[model samples]
Structures are given as C-alpha cells and as structure tokens.
Target: MTFLLGAASALQLPAYQALVPEIVPRKSITDAAALSSVGVNLARAVGPALAGLVIARLGVPFVFAANALSFALFLIVLLAWRGYQRPDTRVEPFIDATRAGIRYILHAGVVRRVLVQLACVMVPANALWALLPLIAAGPLRLSSSGYGLLLAAVGLGSVGGAFLMPAIRTRLGIGGTVAVASVIFGATSIALVLVPSLPVALAVLIVGGVAWIGVVTTLNGTVQSFLPAWVRSRGLAVYQLVLFGSTAVGSALAGAASSLFGVLPVMVAAGALTAVSAVLLAARPFPSLTGRDRAPMPSTDVPPVTEHDPALQGDVLVLVRWQVAAGHVRAFLTSMDALGHSRRRTGAREWTLHRDRDHPDTWAEVFRVGSWQEHIDQQTVRRTGDDAGIFSAVREHASDDPDIEYLITPDRTETPHV
Candidate 1:
C-alpha cells in the first residue's frame, strides 16, 4: 500500500505543479505556490482530526470510505474543468522530450544549485517527521489525541507561515529566507529533544512548521520561476525526485543512528548538521533570478528545407568562428563559458570551444542539435532574453562578427569533415 501510494504521488505532484504557471499570471506565481502549500498544510491540520473522530464514532472502514469519496469528487471536478490553451508548437517525441528535459537541467547552473540547496536542507529536516512519533511515544509520553494535536499545531503554523511568506521573501530574499528558516528548524529539532515537556515541544514544533513552509515554498517557487515552459514539468519532476529521495535516505539514516546512539543524540546531530548547512548556504547563495526573461521567442524566418529534405532529417552541426580582440582572450573565454551553457540548456546536444593552434586570436565555437528543426528552434524558440544578453557579451570581446556554418550529413553518406 505504501509503495502504491508513493507511485501515485510521484505522478500527481509534478502534473499539479505544472498547471500553476498556466493558470496564474507570471507575477502571481510566488503567491500561487504559497497558496498550494497552504492548502496541503490546511489538509494536514484537519485530516487527522477528522479521521480520528470518524474512527472513534464510526470505524476505520468509514474513514477509508470518506477518503474514496473525496477522490471521486476530485475526479468529477477534473472532468468538468477546461484545460489551459497551449501554443500550437511541434511536440517532440516522448523520448526526445525527456532527453531535452534532462539536458536542460544538466546545463542549467541555477537549477542545479537550487536542487543542491533543497537536498541539503531536506535530508536533515526530514528527521523531524521520521522521529516525531517516537518522540511522542517516549519523550513527551503523549496520548494519541495529544499526538494528533501536535501534528495539528505544525499544520496550523504552516498555514500562518504561508500568509507571512511574501513579506518574509521581500525582506530576506530567497537565500536569506532559506538560511533563516533552516536555522529555525534546526533550533526546533534541538529543542524537541532537550526540552521534552509536551507543551514546550508543541510550541517548538509550531515554530518548526513555520520554518518548514518557508524553506519549501521559497525553493519550490524559485524552481518554478527559473524553469521555462518547455521543461517546467520535467524540472519539477526532478525536484520532487530529489525532495522525496533525500527524505527516504535521511529517514533511514536517522532511524539507524537513533537505534545505536539513542534518539536524543541522533536528533541533536541532525539539528547541528542542519544549522551548519544553513551557514554554508548563506556563504554561497543561489544566483538571483530577477529581471530575467524566460519567455520563448520562436524564429520568424522559415528554413528553406522541408521535413522530407535529407539534411533536415540528420544531425545539424553549427560552427562559429571568432577573432578575439588583442589582449581579450581571457575575458573572451570567460564569456564563452556562459554562452556554451546557454547553448546546451537551450537545445544543443553538444557544445565546445576551441582555439586555432596556429592563430592564438582565432577561436571556434561548435555545437550540434538533434536535427535541423531543433537547430532552428534553438535560434529563438528556446532562446530567452538572458541568452541574448550572453550572446551580446560574447560579441563585445570579438574583433569582428564571427563566421557561422551549418552542416548536416546526408541520409546515406558519412559525416563530412570540416
């Protein structure tokens, strides 16, 4: 049952998140993300209490029946809803689309950093959830209802935190918000063990809840903002993979360590590690996303070749020659590094920069796309304002406009040497 539930969530989460940007305006995405969190936490606050009452008055079977009924209603609502209007763009094959998504993340430094930050916090933060039942049973010696109340407190606190997020984000920014929230959660974890009084633990959990929502909502929103529409769902799927994978690993480690070292020591270590991670994160914050345009602008010019053209069907290799200005080789290389990533992140299957052995000032930028169609898409469909800026910066170091060439292997012929 647990495995089945996990599989269901694996499908449900990414699809739900992908719909947010489609339904809401770009500026309201952060708020919409927070409201999604608010809904989950609100359910957390109410579900268990209701479940307990139903079990007490009716039975466990009745509680399950109610859950099934909720899902039925959800299906009905989904059936009635009209979906968002997507652009009439060419859709890649499923395998190709999946590969493109993976490639984007591989080349996107900002997204990688966000994922790393999330993992660092999530791995340790999971200790609270993994060990809370143990804490309730042993340290606090609470009854079932009391434990439910503790869960309710965390849920209620998260709901409150959602309302406070815009102000918090405005004040602290993404990095500071994550750092401070990490510290708060770490402190709460430490307090949960050291101060085992039921009342005190409940209070601490409330604070932990606030910190939890803050970190999650901020990071999730950051991912959503950074990802382009073409790969948003895939990126979120990867984010969810990291989030849940880290939780599983953390919970197992916490459980094992708690058995050997005792729950108190294990909790303390997790808390301390979480706080230390916060310090490390603050020292090296994520890159800012402000003022960057991610909207796709398709190329206006039509390609001469049709789909039936053999060259259009084969791999497309693009080569750009650059004559770097005197004494600007180093600066030029630095800018090209950014440009290379942009190429791969946009659509290039491979990208490389090479210098002419004979001519120190001359350089070559080489990239390949799956097909001519994809290369055409790279020109503007996958291009963004940020990519244009990078392109402009690279050009500033060049002595003259670089030469460009496109080549495609014929269907029955070998790839031609340059």
Candidate 2:
C-alpha cells in the first residue's frame, strides 16, 4: 500500500507543480510556489491533530475514509475547472520523450547545477526526519502527542515563512538565501543533540522549518524559472526524483549510522556536514532570474517530409565546418564547448568537435540525432533563448558563416566501418 501510494504521488507531483506556471505570472512564480507550500505545510500542521482526534473518536478506519473523501473532493474541484488550452504540436513517442528528458538533464548545466545543490542539501537535511522520533522518545522523553507537537511547530514555522518569503528572497537572493537557510537548519540539527530540552527543541524546529521552506521553495522556483515550456514537466519530474531519491538514500544511511554509533552522533555529524556543504556549494551560485530567458528561439526550416519519405525515418548526422580567425581559435574552442552542451541537451545523441589534422584553423563540429524528426524538433520547439545566446557567443568567434550538412543513413541494415 505504501509503495502504491508513493507511485501515485510520483505521478501527481510533476503535473501539480507544472500547473503553477500556467496559472500564475512568470514574475510571481516563486511567490506562487511559496503560497502553494503554505497550503501543504498547513495540512502537515493540522492533518495529524485532526487525524488523531478522528482516530480516538471513530477509529483508524474512519481516518482512511476521510482521506478517501478528501481525494474525491479534490477530483471534483479539478473536474469543474476549465483547463488551459495548449498549442497544438506533434507529440513524440513516449520512449523518445523520456530519452530527451534524460539527455536534457545530463547536458543542461543550469538544470544539473540545481539538482546538485538540491542533493547536497537534502542528503544531510534528511537526518532530521529520519531520527526525530528517536530523539523525542530517548533524550527528550516526550510522549506521542509531544512528538506531534514538535512536528506541528515545524509546520507552523513553514506557514509563517511563506508570508515572509517575498521580502526574504528580495533581500538575500537565491544563493544567499539557500546558504543562510542551510546554516540555520544545520545549527538546529546540532542543537537537537546538545540541548535536548523539549521547549528549546520546539523552538529550534520552528526556526528550522523557516529555513527548510526557504531552501525548498527557492530551488524549486529556480527549476520552474529556468526550464523552457517544452521541457517544464519533465524538468519538474526530475526535480521531484532527486528530492525524494535523496531523502530515501539519506534516510537509509542515517538510520544505519544511528544504529552503529547512536542517533546523537549521527545528528551532530549530519549537521556539521550540512554546514560545510553550504560553504563548498556557495562557490557556484545559482544564476539570477534576470539572466535566464526561456522564450522560444526562432525555428529553423526542416526539409519537407511525406509519409513515405526516407528523410523522416533515418538517424541524422549534422556536421558544421568552421574556419577560426587566427588568434581566436582558443576562444572559438571555448564557445564550441558551451554549444556542445546545447546540442546534446536539445536532441543530439552524441556531439564532438574535431580540428582538421593538417590545418588546425579548420574545425568540424559534429552531432548525431536518433531520427530526422527528432532533429527537426530540436530546430523548432526545443531551441530556447539560452540556446540563442550560446549560438551568438559561438558566432562572435567565427570568421564567417559555418558550412553545414545533414547526412542521414539511407538504410538501417547497412553497418559502417570506422
């Protein structure tokens, strides 16, 4: 049942998060995300108390029935709303779409950076969740209701933090906010081990909640802001994957370490590492919102295709020949490195830059796509303002227009010898 519930949640989270952009203005995306989080934390705060009351009065079965009824009510609300109309576009096969999403994450530096930062913080931060009950029962000597109160404190803090988010983000920016939040949460974790007083612990958790909501909302908002529309749902799906996957792995590790050395030692060590990670990760700060442009770039023309056209069916190899200006070879190479990532992120299966063996001034930039249709998608819907900027940078280093060629395999059965 738990696994089934997790699978359902995994499916729902991406769709839910992606809808925020459609419903809210781009400038207000972060604020909207914070408000959405306010609702979630509110539930986290109130749901337990309500459930406990129901369980006492009507039994556990009634709690489950109420949960089911709430879902039914949510579905009814969803059904009543008119949905957004999206532009009509050709849909790729499911397998191909999955491949594209994976490629994007592997090659897009911005997305990769966000995911790395999330994992770094979440792996250590998960220690709090994994061992909090143990801390309450052992050192703090708290009853079950007392433990619930501690959780309620965190939830209350999250609700309060959402109200303060706008001012906090304006003052701190994403990177500074993340760093400060990490330090605060880390300090709270360490306090858990050192202080052990119920009142002090509740206060610490409330403060920690403020920090938690800030980091989560900031990183999540960054993902939403940076990803282009075509890949937004996929990007959010990957974000959800990293967030939950990190927690699962971290929780397992924390539990094992606690068993070996005890919860207090693990808590202290997790806290220290969380604080240290903030320092290391701060070196590569997230790019500001002003810099990211997710608007679609003007589409390049693709060769016309018919139902029987072989051009539409085959793997594609794109080769671009460039002659670098004498002293600009180094600069050209650097620009190509950035462009290579853009190519792979969009659709390229493999990308490489090769200089002519005898003439170092001549360079060949080559990339392969799984199919012609996929390559066309890259030229059209997949290209974004970020890609346009990278292309412009590369063009600045070139002496003249690049020589381009598109080669497709005529037959699938024939294998080429290298």
Candidate 3:
C-alpha cells in the first residue's frame, strides 16, 4: 500500500511541474520558476519544524492522518482551478509516446546539453543534502534541534537566492550565474567538512543553499524554455527521471564512500568533483532562450486526410522536392543538414536528405511520422519560430517553392478518435 501510494504521488509530480510553464507568460518564465523554488524552500524551512511540533503534541498516527488530509485538501483545490484548460490532443499509445519523447530529447542539441549539465552538477551537489544529517549527528556532535537550525538556515538562504535570481541573471547571465553558484556550493561543501564550529557551519549552509537554488532554478527554466507544449509533460518527466535518478545514485554512492572512508573525506571528494564539473561545463554553456524558443508556431497547412480519422491512420510519409541551382548545391546541402536535425527533433520518425541522380540540381527531403494525427501534431505544435527561418533559407536556395507530398498506408483501419 505504501509503495503504491508513493508511486501514485510520484506520477503526478511531472504534471504539477509542467503547470508552471503553462500558466505563466514566456517572458517571465525564469522569474516564475524562481518563485516556485521559493515556495519549495519556504516549505522546507517551515514544514519540518511544524511537523516536529505536531509529532510532540499529538502522535505519529495523527501526524500521518494530517498528512493524508492535507493531500485531500490539495486535491480539492486542484479540482477547483478552472482557469487553465489543457489543449485538445489525441493521446498516443504509452510506449510509442514515450519512445517519441525520448527520441526528441536525444535529437535536440540544446535539450541534451541542459540534461547533461544538470546531471554533472546535481550528482556531486546532492552529497550535502543527503549526508548533512549524518554529518551533524556524527562529526559535528550537534543535537537534532541544531541540525534543524542548520536546515532552516539553508532554506532561508534559498529564499533569498530566489528573490535575487532575476538581478543575478540580468547581471551574469544564466551560464555565468550557474557556474558561480556551482563553485560557491562546492567551496561551501569543502568548508562544511573542515569547519567544526556550529555557527560557521550554519553560515556555510546558508551560502550552499543559495547556490543550490540558483543552479536548480536556472536549469529548470532552461529546460522549460526549450520544450514545446506538445512534448512538455513527457520532456519534463524525463528531466525529473534524470534528476531523481542521479540524486538516488549519488546519495547511495556517497553513503558507501562515507562508510568506507570517512564523512569528511567523502565530502571533500564530492566537493572537488563538483568544482571540476562546474568549470568543465562552463566552457560549453547551456543555450540561451531566444524569442523563438518561447512557444511553437502553428503551421498554416491543412491536414492532408480529411476523410480518414487521423488517430486510426498508420505511418505517414512526407517528401519535399527542392530545385537547387548547381552553384548553390553545397550551401543548400549544408542548410538542409541543420534543418534535418530540426525535423527529427520535431517528431519525424525517420529523416533523410537525397539528391537526384538524374538531375543533380534536384534535392529531396523525406521524413516519416507514426500516424496521421502524429504528423498533424508535429506540423502544428512541434515547429518553433526558428523553424520558419530554416524553411525560408531552404526556399531561398530553391528556384521555386518546394513541392510537398504526404503518403499513408492503404490498409487503414477506422478506429474511434478519442
């Protein structure tokens, strides 16, 4: 029962996280993310102390009951929220959708880079959060209250950092801010190991908390910025999977290392790794969000098959034939290569660029989608404003506008569109 409840709770997390991008304006997405972090940190600061008090006054059963009731209240509030409406979309089979989402992230350069950087920083950074209680009890010889105070200090620092994020981002930019934060946190981790004094440790934790919030919030915003509405939930699910997976693995490893060696030695090693990762990642900074990354542009083209239900239709094939001048062939091919990445990232199952054997000037771009509905969704919601520029560039190289053809399987079974 406990495992099932936990699993159910975890399933809703991505949807809740994805809601922030949907509710807020694109321009203020970074600030909104910061605000969300602030709420989490604020809860971290308050919830524990409140829970302790409740546990002392009441019993463990009462505390658990209260927790269940709180969730019930949350459900009530969620159901009452009628402002945001989800876009109408045909749901794909779970496994196929999951594969498509994974494919899109793997193909997209910016999304891939963000996930890699997040893992690099988060793995080592998790040491402090996961092992701090053990350190407080064993090494520092602090009481439970003292440890709570230390956590409170960290939470306060996170709140401050959240409030200051916009200014820091404006001055330093996202990459610079993350790099500085990582270094600061790494240094603080080392300091926590060295410094035995409680007051000093609290100060170090405050700095560490600020740095933690900065890196996490920035990474969150970066991921949210790049994802389109169609794939936002799935993409975020993958991001959260990486995040929690890394933390779990890091914590387990850190625990083993601490047991083998000592807490201080393990912490110092983690700190060093974190600092090095920050420097290495800073060299290949995360891509900044342009105006184009804010939202996907809707395509003007109508769906090819009006007679058939898109959901029932199987594998879509799209071919575009471009007439290129002999002199522009090389340049056109170069542009097409870049465009191909965009195509694959935006739900194309298979993409290929072909040159005509008979007429060397003629070029063909072919791609496939899983279904007609998938193709429609890909055309309408998967495309970004930047894609328009790419298409325009390709058209510029062509003597005339490119000809497009859509093909589907003949044996299409009619199923009810959900």
Candidate 4:
C-alpha cells in the first residue's frame, strides 16, 4: 500500500508540474498548492471506483497487488528522475535536537491549536472515507457505474473547496475557519446517511468533500505558518502522524461497525464523532493556538533562540528536509539571530520570527526564501549591514548542517517518521 503511494508520487508530481504553465498561480507556493489540490482531486476521483472494481471483480488481494505495482513503478520513475540527495558532510547532537522539537510542540499555543483543528475533523473523516462506497453499493443499491459517478462528484466538490480555502481562511482565521469547517463536515456526514435516494446521497457526499478539503488545506497552512523554522519539518511530521494515526483507528472502527451493524451505522458514527470532535476541540484546543490565545515562555532544558557566540563562521548551513542542527549551541544562535535581523532589515520579502517557547534565548528565525542559498548569500543582508559585522563577532558558533541537500517535491502520502 505504501509502495503504491510512493510510485504515484514519483509519476504524478512531475506530470502535474507539467501543467504549471497552464494554471499560472498567483504566487509560486500557491501554484504548488494548486497542483497538489488538483492532483489529489484527480486521484480521489479514481480511487473509489478503482478499489470497488478490483474488490468486486478481481478480489482484495489483486487490489493490494495493484497498489504494490503502482509503488514499484513510481520507484522506478523516481529513480530515473535526477537531483535527489540525502547524504550529509557532517553530523551533530541529534537527541537534543529531537528534544527541542518536542518541547516546542508541548509549549507553542499556536501550533497546538492548528493540530487540534486538524484532529477534530480528521478522526471522523476516516470513517466517512471507509464507509462511503459500501453504503453506495449496499442498501443504496448503486451499480458500479453509479458508484463511479458518486466518486467523481466528491472529487469535483473537493477541488472547488481547495480553490476557496485561501479566501475563507483569510476571513475566519485558522481557529474560526477550522471550527466552522468541522461543523460543515459533521452536518454533511449525517445528511449523506439520511438521504432517501442515490442522487440526494451523492449531493450530500459532495458537500462533505468540500468541507473536508477546505478544512484540511486551511489547517495545513495554519500549521506551517505557526511553526518555528528550526523545527518546521519535524513539527509537520508530528502533525501528519497524529492526523493519519487517528485515521487508521477510524478506518478500523468503521470496518468493525459495518460488519456488526451496516454501512449506514458506520456512516452515522462518523458524523456523530465529527460533531463531538468539534465540540471537544473548541473547548480544549490541542496542538494549541497563537495570537490572543497564545503565549511565549521560558524553558531551561534547551538553549534559547537568541543565543550568540563570537567564533562562529560560514560552515553554518541551514538544515534541509529532516536535516537537523549538528552544529554548536552558540553558533546556531548567532546564525539564527543574523538571519532574523537580515530578514527584518531588508523588508524585501516576508519572513516570520519565532523564538522557541521553552528556550526563549535560543533564537531560530523561520523563512522560505527563493532558494536554500538565500540564507548564505544573505542577498538582503548585504543591504542591511547587520550581516556584515556579525560573522566577525560570531565565528565561534560556525558549523554545517551535514544533512543539507537539494530535493525534489514528491506526492503526499503517509510519511512514517517517529
């Protein structure tokens, strides 16, 4: 199953990238977002029918085999594509780095809120995905063609929702937006089960799809926006783990309920759980929230984000995908401070400032410039003069992220990182 997803990623990302020239997104990131949205839309449209056909005609083992073959093909295609690198020139203290990530998630109110919002809808969502086809084929008594049409309707609705997410998020804030989306999801889930006919059920499912994609996209943006640069990858990994981990549990429960009661019962359970999750999340706000509901605190176990040493030099490399700080304490701080000051001074592009909630002193500024070298070249830094004398004062902190390397984007799938 995992291999098939990997294979899809290899073939699909590039194939979609080819469509970039046509979409002409408002921003580069938005283009990436659009392609991702559309690509998922395409696959979601096909996945149900494909699964139904394989299970109905070919059998479950064949479905599994097909998935494996897809993964193998994706692996071959990905290997054929160039410029994927994971080797590092040096290594550093990783355990402390892992601790730093955990501490921030535990402490950062904003990150917690985002994670909570995702969880609220996601837990019940797994049930919806699991039971949708079963209900369509069972009492719904829809033929294979009808099921395929229903899947297409859901896919179309999701794509529409993705297009609307940015604007809706802008208006509601992540907190309010997610809260509202959760309501829509729960209500739609119930509606899908209650509908008297296939067409009506199809419409409700489409609405559910819209709610699902919009809430998810908005939540993802919220998570990324709130995370500190030093722990962005790790923070995201944690989010994925929780969301997907709950999904697995949801799917399993859906299967059990379907066997014991019926598909409608499983679908109803999803809706009820979704409603409950919304209420719980609104009250508790896991993963935490920022702004008025957020705070910055001091923790003693890790160094603060603002630390600096006089001896650091050019070896200070910004970590890449899953790449963590293996460098010195003082050096990392100095580099981070320099990056923050540089970004603030230039006013050339948008950059976020995040100090660790626990280690307020160990500063780690977060920003995504045009390229990785944007930090080293400090293009805007040359304009600020802050980058000028800082190195001389802080060479003692200099060290490299041995994990630094260029990477190509891949398909979205379960990334199993503990």
Per-residue lDDT for 366-407 in model 1, tens only?
999898877766775677778878888888999987888888
RMSD for each of the candidates: 3.2, 3.1, 3.4, 14.0
lDDT of 3 by residue, 134-227 (tens): 8899868989888988899899889999988889989998888888888998999999989888889989998888898898888888788677
Ranking by lDDT: 2, 1, 3, 4
lDDT of 1: 0.85
lDDT of 2: 0.86
Residue 98 local lDDT, model 2 = 88
Q: lDDT for every model?
A: 0.85, 0.86, 0.82, 0.57
Model 2, position 143: C-alpha lDDT score:
91
lDDT of 2 by residue, 56-128 (tens): 9999999999899999998998787788766334687899888889999998877898899899989999999
TM-score of 3: 0.92
> Model 2 segments beyond 4 Å from truth?
56-62, 87-89, 300-311, 358-360, 412-418
Q: What is the lDDT of residue 293 in candidate 1?
A: 79
Q: Stretches of candidate 3 above 4 Å error?
A: 301-312, 412-418
Q: Which pairs clash in the backbone of model 1? A: none
TM-score of each: 0.91, 0.92, 0.92, 0.55
Ranking by TM-score: 3, 2, 1, 4
